[model samples]
Target chain A: MKAIGSFKGEPITDSDSLVDVEVPTPDLAEHDVLVEVKAVSVNPVDTKLRAGAPSQKEPLILGFDAVGIVVKTGSNTTKFSKGDRVWYSGTTKRPGSNEAYQAVDERLVAKAPRSLTDEAAAAMPLTSITAYELLFEKMGANFGQLANPGKTLLIVNGAGGVGSVLSQLAKWAGFTVIATASPANFDWLRANGVDQPIDYHDDLETQVQGLGHHFVDAAVILYDVPSYYDAVTKLVAPGGHIGAIVGTQAKLNMEQLKSKSLSLDWEYMFAKGDFDFRMETQGEALRQIAQLVDNNFVHTTLSRTIDSGLNAKNLREAHQVVEEGHVVGKVVVSGPFNGQVNE
Target chain B: MKAIGSFKGEPITDSDSLVDVEVPTPDLAEHDVLVEVKAVSVNPVDTKLRAGAPSQKEPLILGFDAVGIVVKTGSNTTKFSKGDRVWYSGTTKRPGSNEAYQAVDERLVAKAPRSLTDEAAAAMPLTSITAYELLFEKMGANFGQLANPGKTLLIVNGAGGVGSVLSQLAKWAGFTVIATASPANFDWLRANGVDQPIDYHDDLETQVQGLGHHFVDAAVILYDVPSYYDAVTKLVAPGGHIGAIVGTQAKLNMEQLKSKSLSLDWEYMFAKGDFDFRMETQGEALRQIAQLVDNNFVHTTLSRTIDSGLNAKNLREAHQVVEEGHVVGKVVVSGPFNGQVNE
Candidate 1:
């Protein structure tokens, strides 16, 4: 089997940062399904794990979002069968989707939207899963039946992968969306269902107040969280929520959140998969997302596609684009594995 | 009107820490009610404000929980009429309940429990409001009709004012309550509906794990939050909630909460009255609490009562007891104002 991975953490600029290798096929667990990966998206998690990977004897493959076909299933698998097309943002605790054929838990697999291409579908799973859990699970927002008409949500980094999908989900829930991005990406924000896009370089509190909202009902920081924590605490109304996806080693001034009775929701989608806590919900969330897509309630966020295939070169380019930190939606590497083994 | 208050922040041991003062009655707002305070409770908030009081010329009266008779009602008040017995944990933004006559928002007042004594009812309001909000509003625990069987709640400082009531509420919600307290207070914890009470002096993680639970479903820090942050973080299960009532100025290592995707819920019940976010909810919460009390679903946490009345001497003694931080439940002062004005 062909695989692209790293033995040690290195800068994306290095040629060996993401090199091709040949490995034996993985043995399936009872709940596993063997997927022939068709398309995979490069996300911040991919870049983060790649750059900070521990020095290990075995290569650490890193890709979470994938649109693939089920080639085989373990004896106990139930939801997926051989030849069924599936989509998932698999767990990083085990080997991920950056392989020719990968084994994943059936509980985390879902049917991809029939209305979109593999590359377009690949761009959404990881971000869509993250956005859904953060909004519905962590922040406690209603997704379908009831509408949050007067509710407002402020999305920091509204042009990034998660933000691009999160703002759309908030709009679907009938929330007045206030997002932050560069001036050039304001149109991109609006296209993604952002009601108002304020420049991140400007004062967020003043900008939100200028929009006639005293405080946002909810705020989610998809970008650098530590730097934006204080600014966000000030803009969220008392008894509101402030959610974050990024982890920070630095200690945050948690006192600022106490006065207003704010809840700091940390959404790490991988937690459920790694800890075996409600892993089935990931599949359910993806199914709901697919329904929304097929019905035109939401659209795919694939902005760029590497049509040359999922080679080491194309994967590195995708990683570099995501690492630059200004992507409007998502970048995907499509086609079959064409990486020539370095050996 | 007569009151017992502090001129500035001082050690509770000082004779002048709490002194008698005479002041004019406050002007009532459109929704304000003038109450004849019958009983008042001494909580951590009262002592905290006294210990950290700013340099102000006007004496700052510090008491939140009170059982009183509505002596007068404002023009727009609808919830309460003159002569109604009321119970309320008023806001710290205005003059508190330490005076003979105090003006409070009618929306923040509720009918006191018909079965309990004035002193007994006084011990509940402030702590009840805080605990109710922490469990139901912040942590999203099901109350009333739903019984959260098999769910577990860990309460730090179980023998204190908030912890005593919080454990009872958790028990009523069908949660197995694991509480932390001094070895001397274990019996008290049991009396207050704590399923298990561990010593705070020992390793909390090992103790909680020893009880056959790898993690608690929900955790609340009623004691010092900053010191207990990491230990509590480790004990909470993935996707669980960590609720805090105490405010922390020190920075907290938030990364510990990221891997589990936990939520840090800071419950400041006064935020509603302080910021005017949802003043009506306070009254509603108290109403539900009163029903629970009258129905014997829960009992009052008042363990000690100063029958010497709400004079400067009795008030100082109550403040000293709370400041020491080892009381079994709540310490309250009952009877009319007997403070001899310093003038």
Candidate 2:
């Protein structure tokens, strides 16, 4: 199998930062399905992992989101069959989707939406799963129903990958969506179902208050939580929730949330896969997300595509774009493998 | 009206720490219910507030738990009538419960259980409400049902006021309760429905794992959060919840909970009243708690009583006991008001 990997922590501009390599095809365990990778998306995690991860005996493959086809299944697998199309965000502890073939747990894989192309389907899984879990699981929003009608949500960095889908999901869940982004991306945010788009450069507290909401029912920070911690805390209603995907270096002032009896939740997409806790919920979430996508309730967040196909060079380019941190939605590298293979 | 209060932050042994004062009777608001105080319990919050609260033009009264008879009601009040017995944990923003007469919102008061004495009933409201909210609202357990059968809870400082009630509530909710206290309090803990009482003086993780539970579904820190954070985080099952009532002075490492998708919840009993967020729920919780107490499903945690009655001297002594921090359960001052009155 042909794959692109980073041998050591290095800047993306270095030619050897992400190099072509040959690794044996992964073996399937019980409940595993072998996936023939078709399309993959680049996220901020890829960039971070590529630049700072320790050099390993084997080069580290860095990718999480993929749309692929089931090539084979382990003896105990029941949810998927060979040739079935699927989409998922693979586990963090295992080899990722930046390869020609990968083995993923069947419980974490779901059927890809029939209404979208492989590139588009690949773009939705990671962000969709994250957004769904953040709203429903972490923040206590009801799933598959408008249970939170008239409630408000504040999404920081609303023009980014997770924010793009999260705003739509939160809106569909009957919450009034307030998102923050640059003025240049305001239209994009509004088009994606954001009820109010506040410029991130402005004073967030003042801008949110200008919209007549004294406090939001929930706040999701897609960016640095500490930088916006004070603002987010002040904007949260009593007994409300604040969720974050990005880890912070600064110590958090937990006392700020004490008076309101608020909750601080950390939503890491790989947690279930990493700890083997409720892994089937990922498949369930994806199945529902696929229905939402096919029903036109949600559209693909694929903002850019590397048409040159899945190769070391194209993936490197995608990583560089993600590292820049201002991409409107998602950047995917698609098509057949073009790197050298030893298998 | 005669009241006991502190004019300045001072040691409980100081003669002026808590003194008798005569003030005008409180005027009623639209939803106010005036109660003739009978008994009140001393909690750590009372001690902390009494010793650290700023001096005021009017002496600061510091009591939260009270059992009394309703003497009057405001125009819009409907929950209670004159002469009805009631129990409540009043709002922190109000004058509190250490007085002959108190004006509390009708929505925050509930009928006191007929099965228990005034002192016993008074010991319950604050801790019961805190325990109920921590389990059901904060940790997502179902209210009044054995919804979490076979699940486990770890309650730190299980002999304290909140812990004593929380252990019983968790048991009633069908969760296996694991509590930490000194070996001397093991009998008290077991009597309060703790299934496994580990010595807080020993290694917590080793003690918990030895009891055959690698992790708990929820962990509540009734004491210091930072001191128990590492053990609690490690002992919480994946996708579990950790709640704290006592605030931490140290900055929390929120990243430690990221890998397990754990939630850090702050449970302040006065939050709803402080922010006017769902104040009716406190009364609702108390109503259900009263039913539980009357049915003998849960019992009062009042371990000690001061026969000297509701006066400055007795309150100061109670404060001293709470400040010492080794009491088995709640310490309360009961009987009639024996102080000078303005009327």
Candidate 3:
């Protein structure tokens, strides 16, 4: 199979940053589906891994969000069959989807929405899964029918990929949404279900307080974890939940959260993929997300499309786009080869 | 009314550290009870308050755990009548339980155990309330029957006032209790119900792993917040709950808790007392705890007592005993005054 990967860390602009190579396509297990990837999206993790010089014997393929078509199915596969279109956020520890053909656990892959194009579908999986898990799973958002609609959500760094999708989902789930972004993306974020878009450039706590809400009932932190610990601690209402996906080595003063009886939860989407539990739940969430998208209740965050062929040069271009740091929504790279193509 | 109180921050040995002061006895308000305090137990909070030289125009009486006889009840009082034996963990922010005659909110007081002495009853509240809230409320330990018993709890600083009771409660609730204490108190901690007591003097993580339980489903840190961050983080089972009662000013690395989806909860028993919500529940838990003691289901940690004559000199002696750091359970001082006193 033809794949794009990196062995050494370097700037994406460097010629050797990413290389086109041939590697053995993963063998399908009982629950595995062989997917021929058609479109893939670039995220911050891709650039972070590329710049870090990760130690690896084989080249590390660097794509997680992918839209593909199943070409073959293992004997025990029950969810997908040959010719089925699928979308998923691939496991973090294993090989990724910057390749022509990839084998994925059938439990983590869901049928692609018929209403959207492959590029649009590819951008939704990684961010949607992250946002979904952070809000509903990690934060334990009550989905009971009687849940109050007056609850509030504060989404920090709200114009990013995950935040953009999360804002809409939080609103759909009956929360009044408060999004934080720069003045530039205020209108865009407000149009996407945010009740208010407070400027992130200002003191976040002051800005949030200025909006007349004393505190948020829940919050999702999308940027640096350490920078907003105090702000989140102060802004969260008593007994509220705060979820973050970002990692930090800095010390966290757990005591700051004690007075308000606040709870801090970390949502790493990779846990399920790496630990191999509740994989089907991710797939189910994806299918439900697709239905919401098809019903025009939620929209994709694919803000830019770059036709970097599924090769070293194009992969590096995608990497550079993510590293630029101000991606409005998602940057998806369309296919160099259709799902039907074989080596 | 005579009370022992501190006007300045000084060692307990200082002659003037605690002075006898005459203050006006409080008039009973609606839902108020006038109790004649007979016995009171010393807790760490008393020492912490003493060390800080808490501001007070008049001398400030510092003790939260007390047992007494109800001398008078307001017209609206329904829970107890005059002459009822009672015990309580007083409000941290309010005037505490160190005076000859004290007026207490009717809601915070509970019926003292019929089978136990005043000192025994007083010894249970502050620690009992802290432990009950930390386990059942903060850590979400199910107090109902058919609770999940497969879980394990690692109680750091298990020989302190709160730890001494929480270890037994965790065991009674069917959890595997792993407590940390020094060699001197190992036998006492085990006898109280701790299945395992790792010597906190050694490296905590290595000691915990050496006990064959590599991780815990929940952890309650009663003291020494800053020093145990690493060991607590490493020993937390995936999707575990970590609750701490003490506050730490040091910044912590929040991202270390992300991989396993661990939750951090701070339990300040004082919050509810300060905010005035469901105050009756404290009394109810205390009443139930009294029943547990009457049936010999629980034992008091009070080990020593002194008749302090309700004066500053005797109060200092009580404080000295608590400050020595080797006291296993609790210290109590009874008065030569007409007040309800129970331990």
Candidate 4:
């Protein structure tokens, strides 16, 4: 099987940063489903892993989001069968979805949205799962339930991949969505379901307050938590929740939340897969997200797609575009494997 | 009205630390219930407030937990009448319950347990509400539901005020309760529904693992967070919750919880009163707790009662006992107001 991988933690500018390699096909575990990956998306996790991950003896495949067709299944697999089209953000502890053929836990795999293409489907799993979990699990929003009609959500970096989907999900869950994005992406943010799009460069507290909202019922930060910590703390209403995906370099002053009875939660989408805790919920979430996407409640956040096909060269280019940090939404490498085959 | 209060932050040993004074009777708000306090409990909050609260022109009355008879009611009050027996952990924002009379919001007060004395019922509201919210609201435990039979909880300082009630609440909610305290308090902990009581001075991880649990579903720290953080993090199961009442002075290394996707929540019982967010829920929780107490599912954590009554000297002595920090459970002041009446 041919895969795009990196052996050393190096900048994307280095030719060896991500290169094509032939590796043996992965063996299936009892709950595994072998997927012939058709498309994969590049995320901040890929760039971060490529730049700072310890050098491994074997090259580390670094894509978490993929859309694929099931090629084989383990003897004990129950949810999926061969020939099924699936989408998932696979585990971080195992080899990722950047390879031609990868074995993923059946519990994390879900049928892709029938209304979307493989590239569009691939763009969603990671960010959609992240957004779903961030809203429902971490922040205590009811799953697909409109129980909180007047509630408000403040999404930081609302034009990004996770935020684009998150804005839609928040709106679906009955939150009046307020988001922060660059002026260039304001229209896109509004189109994605944000009721108000404030420029991230402006004073966030002032901007949020200007909308006649004293504080938001919940706040989700998709980017640097430390830089947005004070703003989030100030913007979150009493008994509100603040969730983040990224880890902070410095220690957080947790006492700031004590007075407001605010809750601070970290939503790492890979935690379930990494710890083997409630992995089935990931599949359930993806299934629900696919339904929403098919129903047109959520649109694909695939802003850029490399239609030339999946190869080390194209994946590297996708990684470069993601590394630049100005991409509006997701960047995916689509179509069948074009690299040299090993088996 | 006669009240025991402090004009300056001073040691309990100081003569004027908590002195008897005459203050004007409180004017009731539309939703206020004026209670003739019969008994009040001294918690760590009282001692802390006495030691460092800023001096006020009028002395600050610092008791939060109280059981009293409603003497008067405001026009808009619906929950209580003029002759009802009520118990509440009143707000910190107003003059607390350490006086002859207190005007508290009707929404924050609930009927006292029918089976217990005023002193016994008084010992519960603060700790009970704290425990209830920490378990249910902050840590995601289902309120009044036995939804988690196999789940386990680790209660740090199980013999303390909040911990004593929390252990029972966790047990009632179907969690297998594990707690840490001195060996002397182990029997008390067991009586309070702790399934396994480990010595706090010994190795906590080793003690917990010896009980055949590698991790707990949840952990609550009634004392210092930073001191128990590492142990709590290691002992918490994947996707578990860790809650605390006390704030840390130093910055916390929150990244330690990232791998397991654990949440760290701070439970401040006064938050509802301070921020005016969902004060009704406090009353609802108290009403539920009172029913639990009356039904014998939970018991008052009152270990000591100052029968000498509510006065400056007895309150100061109670404050001294709390400041010493070795008491097994709550210390409370019972009986009539002995100071000179203002009216």
Stretches of candidate 1 above 4 Å error?
A: A54-57, A339-343, B54-56, B339-343
Tens-digit per-residue lDDT, B235-316, candidate 2: 9987788999998879777778887888898989899999888899999999999999999989999989996779999999
Per-residue lDDT of model 3, residues A1-343, tens digit only: 7888888897888988888877887888889999988899998988888889765669888899999889999989898878999999978777899988888888888899888899888889989988887777667675432253888999999999899998888878888889889899998798678998988888988888898987788888888978998999888876677888888887776766788667788877777676565678888888888888887778888888876457777777778888999778988887674223453
User: B294-324, model 1: which lDDT tens digit per residue?
Assistant: 9998899998999777888899999998888
Candidate 4 chain A: worst-modelled 10 consecutive residues by lDDT: A334-343
Q: After TM-score superposition, what is the CA distance of residue B83 in candidate 1 from its true location, in Å?
A: 1.2
- TM-score of every prediction relative to native: 0.96, 0.97, 0.85, 0.97
Reference-based TM-score, model 1: 0.96
Worst 10 residues of 2 chain B by lDDT: B334-343
TM-score of chain A of 2: 0.97
TM-score of chain B of 4: 0.98
lDDT per residue for candidate 3 within B141-232, as digits (tens), equals: 77843265788899898988889888878887888888889988999799778998888888888988888876778888888777887789
DockQ of 4: 0.61
- Candidate 3, lDDT over the whole model: 0.81
What clash count does candidate 1 reach? 0
lDDT of 2 by residue, A1-343 (tens): 8888989998989998998888899888998999989999998889988999887879899789999999899989999988999999989889999999999999999999999999998888889999998888877888765778889999999999999999999888889999999989999998888999999999999999999998998999999888999999999998889988888769888788888888998888898898788899999999999999999888999999997778888998999999988789999999888855433
